[model samples]
Target: MMRFILSLVLLPTLAAAQTPAADQARAAADALEAASNMLDDADGARDRVRALTETIQAFESGLGAMRTGLRQAAINEAQLTKKLQSREEEVAALLGALQSMGGGASPVALLHPDGPMGTARAGMLLAELTPALNARADALRTDLENVQTLRALQTDAAKRLQEGLTEVQAARIALNQAMANRTDLPKRFTADPVRTGILIASTETLDGFASGLSEIVTDEIEPAPVNLDGQIGELRLPVQGLILRRAGEADAAGVKRPGVIMATRPGAIVISPTAATIRYAGPLLDFGNVVILEPQADTLFVLAGLDVVYGEAGQVIAGGTPVGLMGGSLAEKGDELSPLREGTGTERSETLYIEVRQANRPQDPVAWFRTDEDG
Candidate 1:
């Protein structure tokens, strides 16, 4: 029974032992589990939306339970403090009385002045009761420790919960908005399935696939009017996002690379910022679906991390032409952000990587596009 009480007090800390690392592992497993479970129970995107919404509601309910538990813990701590204080005084008074009454000399005789057998029996009983009193006193100290631990947990929870509330609101709103934007995107062109599939499957390098696309020349495509000469710092960004990276900066892998990485919204419209000919519009290595555009004879612009590509290589796409859509939470191309849902606006975000090259040399893209203050 004593062990059980200690376990109850340790419950909060034990639960928190599953750190962010544990959460990542659990989330991966849960995603697989959810996918398997949802296969039979779900039908389409709407079903997924409903499932996600339901999960959120369930989490909210758990939050309510946590709040209730915290309230009870606070009340229990206060009450226990009061009870233990009085009990401590009582124990001290009893000990003082025992000492003054000469319990040290002949405890049995002092308690029972009746007969020899009575004193012996009382002595044996007092020996057993002494340990019991000590045990009770030790339990009081343990209870105080438990109370302190519980209060700390509650304090941590409130701080984390307060920070997370703003994030939750922002995430849900962004996700829903992305879904809506995806629905609103106008279907301009339909890709040739057989050609795209063969291209993605057969080509080992992006350059090789781009060369193949360039071979399929058509006269229907129109050239963009953007003048590549003296247009530095005058071009609009190809997509809406926060520029998190600049050219020549080191990435997490510690490699000094050319190009910029933007944290973008899901389902964001990707456009060609100038009159350019498509050099590539397909997947390559870890870049997901990529699109390379050549606005001038010596300049090339690279756009990657798209969910869908709308233009073809050798096709002259005009300035502001919709080239693709940003990959989102519901993106079908097996992107990273999948399995792990979109993060809280910053870390583990949907990123678009862009590059600008002149004569095959890396150049800073920041000078070419307008920078936003929000980033």
Candidate 2:
């Protein structure tokens, strides 16, 4: 009876113990899903940009065709003008010759030996020349009108092409921003728990079975040093804040993917996580303000995308040293009496990303985070 009572007492405690870890895992999963969704959005934006680009290209091609037509029309107009001038000169010369005859002979008499034949011949010639000249002039006028119509169409088309090109450029810029935001997502998580758990369980099962048979085992291991230059430990948080993201995750909120992220109120002092020499300090790709510390020979600790940064690359920084002041909406002052004003809520909610890499490959950052009990 006493043992049963003890079991009942322990059951609730055991259940409570499991809850936090499970909750943490669920939270991690949710974050990963968010990151995935952000990536999808980015991809959709990219597709839009691509489609717009294609449309712009097509319009440009059409514009080229319109230009060719304009050139051809110009040539046709010049040829028609020359032909009209020749026809006008011929008519003028014929009229002058008739005038030179000085009315001594009938114009019809000059065309034929007999009066009847001469009149008939003159009438026939005038009828043919008048109609031919009128028809040629009309043809030229129609061609000129057609050229004007085409010119107007080309002008309109050119304007439309310019607008399309402008839209394509805007879409491209948006796509680039979306791609940058998506990159932050993967950096927020360690290995996906579902996959990691399976691998770990499989390995453990294999190890257990092998141990029973006394089989020789070979472990393929990657070497990692815990400290850099015998002075700095592994990279850690320089300030107290929530880790908003880890390395290799996508950032749904940022204009670009962040290598790491920490959330603190804006205007909050940001510090170095360890005492180490800065390897790189400046603007990084997509990280507005960045600082990289070589905490160990094999590891590079990255603090980046800050609105403000105080340190330079190659400078030595001690752990807890003020590296910069956080900017954005989330920053706040400890007290109303304090002269320092906090950042706006939006800025205060901003995150700082942290990344650690060895040989340019990403490793899980959670392994380095100290457990709550240890702290």
Candidate 3:
């Protein structure tokens, strides 16, 4: 009877002792901690906007990791809880049986009806079962510990999520302020707005507008001819995004152009890919907000479809300087967390049109920017 009752406790197979969910949770906590530290360091950085950008990215990555960890932890906890609940009666019976037998510590508890020989045989049998029973006990203990740890981690992760969201928002606000106050870039020449308006009014096509760009130059200070011999195919993209349409590739409407179309997230930063002079910055025809850059004499890089255009025409900006921001409404807090629940990446809702012209002829943009790697 004692053996039969005790065997009931081992009826439920214990889960693996390793706590993968706990490991994931710990890693997520570390990522969040690193993001917090990065945010603190951003205050003293040389490029405040860039620093804040990095900080926001870090916070976003950490929050994503935490969400994944919390989800896995929850699943593991639920599985363990269900398993334990199913064997609840067996566990209770085992405890009662052990208590009645004085936990197998009393010699009288092991005595058999057939006297010494039977008693010895029963003891041997129990010895064989002891190791298996102990192993199950250890695994059960680990499962219970994991459940508790996962519960605590989930609770703590919620607090961290809120903190991360708040910090990222602050960084974004700081970035905006920094961009608005910036005014230290050099200028090759200032553009004549009146002449630019006249040129736009006369031109009907992008080619025609670009060809007459020199007509709007009020300050005709010629830029030094830039030698791009060694940097032909190694240039970074002006914005962080995925290449949606390659140069000369037809779109849904079967419209093909010599430039690539990039899909970017809302409010994503657009930077100058190289040290360049801004030839034009404003709306032109149906291109929406445009910023045409002259990285070299007779070479123009036209960036169109921007929500906001930064820097006036003729300003000499350094590589990686903020140029503009992509158009779209910022996601709310609930929307930011949508990726966690939906298992999808942040949506790229804005598109930027890029055209590279050399010696007045359009060139394939993929030859100028690396597109094999992830944005």
What C-alpha RMSD separates each model from the true structure?
A: 14.6, 30.9, 5.7
> In candidate 2, what are the lDDT values of residues 1-375, reduced to their tens digit?
434432332223322232222333234333334433443354455454334333333332332233333334344445645665666765455445434433466654555556778768876887777666555444544544444443343344334434433443343344444333332111111223343334334543322311221112123122232354433234445544556666556667543332445665444445666665554444544447666655555566666666656544334545654555455542122221111221122323656666666555545555554312110
Query: Tens digits of per-residue lDDT for model 3 on 1-375?
Result: 556544544443333334776677678778878878888888898887677766766665566566667677778888989987887876675466455544546666567999999988988987787676556655566666666666776677767776776776677677778878777877788788888999999999888898899767866676676677789789988876779899889999999999999987676667788888999989999999999988888889999999877788889887777677788885665554343542444456789999999999999989998777444
Q: Which stretches of candidate 3 lie over 4 Å from their true place?
A: 1-158, 202-208, 339-342, 372-375
Q: Each candidate: what lDDT?
A: 0.57, 0.44, 0.76
Candidate 3 versus the native: TM-score?
A: 0.71
Instruction: For residue 240, give model 2's deviation from the true position in Å.
Output: 2.0
TM-scores of all predicted structures: 0.41, 0.32, 0.71
Residue range 88-126, candidate 1, lDDT tens digits = 766565445445433346544465667878877977987
Best by TM-score: 3
Best of the two (1, 2) by lDDT = 1
**Models sorted by lDDT, best on top:** 3, 1, 2
At residue 163, what lDDT does model 2 achieve? 42
**TM value for model 1:** 0.41
